[model samples]
Every structure is written in C-alpha cells, then in structure tokens.
Target: MFKPDGNYPLQLHGFLRDQNKIWTLSRENYEALKNVQTHTFDVEGNVVKVQFNPARMTSTSAKVDAASISTRRCFLCRENRPPEQNDFHLDEDFYVLVNPYPIFPEHFTIPLKEHLPQLIEGRIMELVRITSELTDEYVVFYNGPKCGASAPDHFHFQAGNKDFLPVFEKGGIKKEKSIWTKSLFSAEVSGIDDGLRKYILIESGSPESITAVFTHFDQAYRDFRDDDTEPLYNLVCARDGDNFRLLVLLREKHRPSYYFAEGLGQILLSPASVDVCGVCITPRQEDFYKVKEEIIKEIFNEVFISSDQLKKLEEII
Candidate 1:
C-alpha cells in the first residue's frame, strides 16, 4: 500500500525535507509550491481550480517535438536526475520518487527503471495495481505521451493526495449516469458523462480482467483516432473497496487553439490528466487570473473526443 499506517507520507516528507537542503531545483519548486497562487470558479456545476506555478513552466512549455526531445537529456533517467532526490524501487521496472514540481501537497512521480518512451500500450494495469495499493490516501494517474507528459521520453506515472482532486468530491459509479459498455469477462467499462468531462471508468477486482478490458479499449481508441500512433488521452486510477476504477479522459487535442492564438485569445495554460479532472494549470500569473468558466469549457470541448469519435468507440462494444 502507498501509505501503510501513513508511513510513506512521513517517509516522503522526510525525503522532501532532506532534498530541499541540497537540491536547489527541488528547494525552489517547494518554495514555489508554498507561494503558488490559485483561483476556483464554478463551471457547469464543476468547481474547477486554476493554479499559477512558475516552477511548472518547464512542463507547460515543453517542446515535445521529436527533434527537440532528442536534443535534450532525459531528466527522468537516474543518472540525469538530481543527486539529492531519493527513490524507492517500486518493482523491477519502476521507481517511486517525489515530484519536485508538485500539484498536490504531497506528490510523487513514478518512473520506469528503464529509459523508455512514454506510451500506455502495456502499462495500464500497473496503474490499477498502484491505485489499489494506495486506495486510502492517494490516487495514481497517467499522462499520455502526446497529451500531457513532459518527460515523454521516459515512461512514468504520477501520484497525488486524493483529497485534492475534485473528482473524489463526487459520488461513485452507482450514483452517476453511465453508458456501460461490453466488458471482458467479469470486468466492466462504462462511460460517464459528468457534464464537465467525459470519463470512461473501468472496474474490476481481477488484474487479468482489468487488463483485458483496458487493452481492448486502448486498441479501439487507437483505431478510432486519425493518426497512426496511440490516441491522445488522459487517465486516472483509484480503488473502490476491493475493485479498481480506471478513469480515461478521451482527448482529441493536446492544447486548445487559444494556446497559440494572438492577443487576448492566448492563455498559457496546459491541460493534463489532472487538469481533465478539474485542476487546470496556468504557468503564467496573467493566464491564471484571466481564466473564466467560458475558457474552461472551451478547453474541455477542444481536448475531449468529439461525439462522432466517441460513437466509434462505442461501436467497439
């Protein structure tokens, strides 16, 4: 479990305390987290929060183009990471480390041990497992390589305090409207239209069953997308009793048109998996103050899968 008797929380806080003393970047980010500005507004019944954290500019303004990515050293790689940062070996292939630029009060970045390209092709089940283990205190999340990952060159997942996400503030699947899709074996896949965002939640107790349903959904999404690569999407996973819930945020675009628009149209905002769940990030102070309900709605509209694309996914059922 992630926070067994809440020891992981203490251990991580200790790591952060130690890192801040020697790791300048980590210290700076921690300071930024303390002073980060935020504003919340109700949008279509969803109270979305916008944050201005200058430390996150690296991620928000990441140049994910192949050429640009190749030219830079992969920071997620062990040798490239700051020496003061501590990590716990999660498995033969992943390491759990505190995220220096944090979104939650206590945030973690779990990266693959091998330096691998970021892709969800075969890793979705791991997300479910991690979430199940940390059910009580934290939620595990994934950022699709093209959707929100700043370190797409290195496969990784992020974890954050569950209380911070607005999604947890809502009720469970039984209380929400959903379009239950055909699932694999005993597993279940259902699309929830939560007015704020379209979410596909996968539920199952068996890892094998969960993997089967997600693998099927992943393929269907790729086939439905126009590009020849993995489709754009954001994901989050948490546990519900003995079962795991995988929330998929189907995306069609990485950034809204306003990201590149001129004058008032431009907002230096980057929508990630967390953002899809109601906590949008604005690296610039001006952008954070300028955010309103209409702009928030527009971002969702641009990034979420179109109605036709979604219908094609339902056809998979």
Candidate 2:
C-alpha cells in the first residue's frame, strides 16, 4: 500500500487530482465518502455494527513486538532502499522524500543519513534553516522515538502546512494567561497542558536571537542531568513575521492507560500517543470522529504513566 516513489496506485490519481491544490474535496462530499464499515462482537455471540466510520473507530491491538526491540536495522538510514527515485534524493547529509502516505497533499520528510537519535545537535539547526528558506508554507516538527516516533531507528522529522491541520491555523498560545489551555477540542482531554519552563532557540529569522535562545535551552537540558539521560524531547518552531514561538515538550517516565484500551467492544477511536499528544494530521473526517475522546485520554495516561509508574504518580498528584 505504501509507494514511497511517486508511482503510487492509479487510484490515488482519483483521490488527488492535483497536487498543488489544498482541500480538494468539500466538507459534505468528504464526510459522505469517509463512511466505512466496522464490525464488533456482541455478548450474544453475534457481530454488531456499533459505530460508523465517521462516528468512531474500532480499536485494534497495535503490533508492538517489532517496535519494542532495542536494536533495529533501518533501511532508510542504511540506504538499503530510499524513498522514491524522482520525488526524493540525498542532499549533503540528509535524504529528502515526499511522504508517501502524507496527511497533507504535499507533505515531505527530511531524514538524517545516519541513524543517530540525538537531534539536539547542530544537524537539526541545519534542517530548520534549509526548510524555513525553501518550504512554501509548511511547518516542520520532530518526534522523539519514545515520544511518538514510529520509526525510532533513523532520526527524521515531519513537515506539513497550516491548511492541513486545523490546530496550527491560529496561534498565540491557546489562552492568554493559563499555563494549560485547550483549543481544537470541544472536550477537556482533547488537549492537556505540559511544558518546559525554559527553551533555547538555535536559529530564527535573526541569526543572533536564534543563537541566544538555542544556547539557553541546550545548557538547561544538559544541566538537568549531569550523569543521566534526559527525557526524549519534541519541539515545534513556527515562523511569525520577525519572531517565532518554539513549543517544546520533554518526555517523562509515565505511559498512558488508553494505549491498552484497544479491542474493547465499543469503538474507542483515539489516535496513538503520537497523534493525540503530539502533532497528528488527519486527512479524513472519519479519523476525527472515530477517534474517541476516551481513547485519547487513555493514550495520554499510557505515555505519561506506565502501569508500574501510575501508583507513584498518584502519590504526587
């Protein structure tokens, strides 16, 4: 199903008539076709149609066996096979490829040539610099392996524009004064507030300010753990006129409970820890509706608090 090269299924041509255009389908038309069938088991030993595609998604257990391994042989990094021939190519130190299963029409990913996990190094700064200068309207983000990265073997980041995701369309922090605020979600768990009191911007519109901010945050993180590994870090920096707002998150020890809620009778359609907690791009209405709020809350619990760590967190909360 995945065709990293531009030569994807011919059916995709029907799905995407033109690559340049955004929001190709109207809301009504999009909603109508997004409906797909889901099957669930009933107590009476029969199958039931509990929810429609646009309603909720039936949770299924994730194949965590392969992902749990400490060591992985990354084909992307090793150049065993690259993304697509025409669509992407190797730059000086990175390989550029258009995301084959892009949520946004023209989504692209720039991955490191080596399989190093440490992104706080100078390499990330170079990537941000290149993207900011070349990308049309896209915003780039990094997902730490433990945070939400599906492919933890190779270090890579995601890029998409504001038109694709509703959450990034407008910004100024969700609220004017609250440390924790919510937007995009009608419910409370749609978003939760967590933060790093300090941040350093490595580069920005003004090279000088970028240098200052980067120095500040980097040193703080190093100081946080003189001998221990700091939590996996995720950060999003957006261009706003002459300045930028850098959103940074430090991964913690707790994993959420909703992650294990898969396969329940009811459709618990929440996205994984990455999509809900981090930047998730959903192209279809089905994904939005089917992804249940309860499921998302459970995922949050799992990401931040593992079963073993839950009791310990209870004492602090």
Candidate 3:
C-alpha cells in the first residue's frame, strides 16, 4: 500500500527485511555486503572509491545489445520477475523493489509497471518527483541505456542511501565550481567541467520549472550531438527542503578501452551513474587491485565528454 503520509525510509527498511526472509538470493547478497572490500584513490585531490564487489559481475558484464536483449527474458517484466520478489507501489505506473544484486547498503529499484524502453527524454519530471518525494532518505539516479543500465529494455530508476556517492562529498562537486551559470524559467543551470568529469547541474525549487529547463537543455544537447536518439549521459538527483539538485554527467562512450582489452589488459569495469558520481565498482578482484590513479584517470578520460565538448555544449544550451 502507498502511504503518502508515512515514512518512506522506514517502509523501505521493512520491505527489505521482509524480502530477505523469503528470497534466498537476495538474503545471501545482502549478507555478503558485510565483506565487500573498498579502497580509495586520490584523483586530483578528489577521493574516488573503488569497491571490489564480485556479486556485481552480472551487471558489470551484461550484454545489452539488441540481439542479446531480444533473446533473453526481460527480468524486469512482472511475469519474469522472481516469485519471492514483492514490490511497493510507488504510483500507478511504478513499483519499488529491493535490488537483489545491491551496490548500496540499502538499495532499491523502481521500475515502470508497463514494459517500456529505457529513455529519459519525456520522463525527467518523473525523476524529479521521485527524488523530491524520497528526499528525506534517498538520492535517485538514472543510468542511460547505452551508459550503465543492465536492463536497457526496461524503464527504471534507482535509489540509494543519501550521501553514499562521493560526488556529494566535500571535495567532489562542492569543490568543483561552475564554469557557466544561467537561469532559465525558474531553474538555475550550471555547466561544470572538473577535469575528470563534465556535468550539467540544474537546481530549482519547482518541479515544473526544472522539467522545463531540462527539456530545453535536452533539445540543445541532442542538436549538439546531432543524434536522433537520446544523448549519452547519466543523472543523479537529490533534494533538500524546497530545492532540488540534479547532476547530469555527460558521456563520450559507455566503457573504457581497457574493458575490451583481452587477457591481462582486460578490466571488467562498467561505469554508470554511481561510478561517475565517484564510487566505481570492479566486479573482479584482479581488476580491483589492478586499478591505480593512472588507470582511473584513463578510464574516466576515455568515457566522459572532453572539456572542449562541455564548453561547446554549454554554448549550445
């Protein structure tokens, strides 16, 4: 049942505990979270966390191509979902369920009820609303189809514990000031190129206005890329009081060259919204140990849009 006046975080905690009792896979994975190893690398003064989470191998190495997706059963589909996995109704269109393969201590996947392609063009407002409503306990994020989404065939959003990502930390986005700032409608838009990452930060007190500004920016970005499809990017949104902060991380490619490199050269790392935001996941233990500052720089440099691209995009928007 959906309770508008109830505490969402408390409700989610209850839901998670209930699921763990019935779902052995989810229970085991959540238990395994206790042993997940992590280390940090200082990248240009910003701390980037690298987590050795072997359970994430399924997501890190997912085959999202058209042919592969068509052949496999859609896991997000209601009929195909595991019988033990129950969900809370977020609204008429979506359901909130515990992610069996979790990255956060308390992770949740909110997928649309109808089977739909994972695209954010017309759904930015939905993201804004979800972020705002759940602001008290969680931060919402979206991984673009070609970016980090394992189930690109399904439209969904993910929520994790607030301040879990490094980007929300002191030296992350807070230290990286805006290169360009402008006000469109009732929203404040800023362009940030912090050497390692390029971002479009949008802040607004009103949801409608934020959506309008994002739409305008989206069209400008589409024109800049000259692509009919949605531009490559990942999004993170957090709300504080009446204000909402949305970070749009631009992308040049989905995976780094090392990901495709064979044998010893290979690093099975696939960065999405979470990785771009600062905590990168390496599903293989070897890759976790192999990653260094230079490697992190290389992977980040290869995937994120260049400084010149961000500048041009700023002008276009």
Top candidate, metric lDDT: 3
Candidate 1 lDDT tens digits, 142-195: 998889899889999999887788877765233255644656668777776656
Instruction: Output the TM-score of candidate 2.
Output: 0.56
TM-score, every prediction: 0.90, 0.56, 0.96
Window of ten residues with lowest summed lDDT in model 3: 1-10
Q: Candidate 1 regions off by >4 Å? A: 1-10, 172-175, 179-183, 226-228
What is the C-alpha lDDT profile of model 2 across 1-317, one tens digit per residue?
A: 11123332232333333332334233233344345333232211211122333311211222223455355445445455432322233345665554444444444566776777634555445534544543335566766555555565567776655344433444323433223322211111111232211112232355334434444444555554452343455655555444443445444532334333355433333332224323332333444355444443443444442333322222221
Misplaced by over 4 Å in model 3 are 1-3
Name every residue pair that clashes in candidate 3: none
Instruction: Rank the models by TM-score, top first.
Output: 3, 1, 2
Clash counts for all predictions: 0, 22, 0
Error of 2 at 6 (Å): 21
lDDT of 1: 0.78
Q: Number of clashing pairs, model 2?
A: 22
Q: What local distance difference test score does each model get? A: 0.78, 0.40, 0.87
Across 195-313, the per-residue lDDT of candidate 3 in tens digits comes to: 67888988888888888888988898888888979888798888877788888999999999999999999999999998988889999999999998899998999999888777777
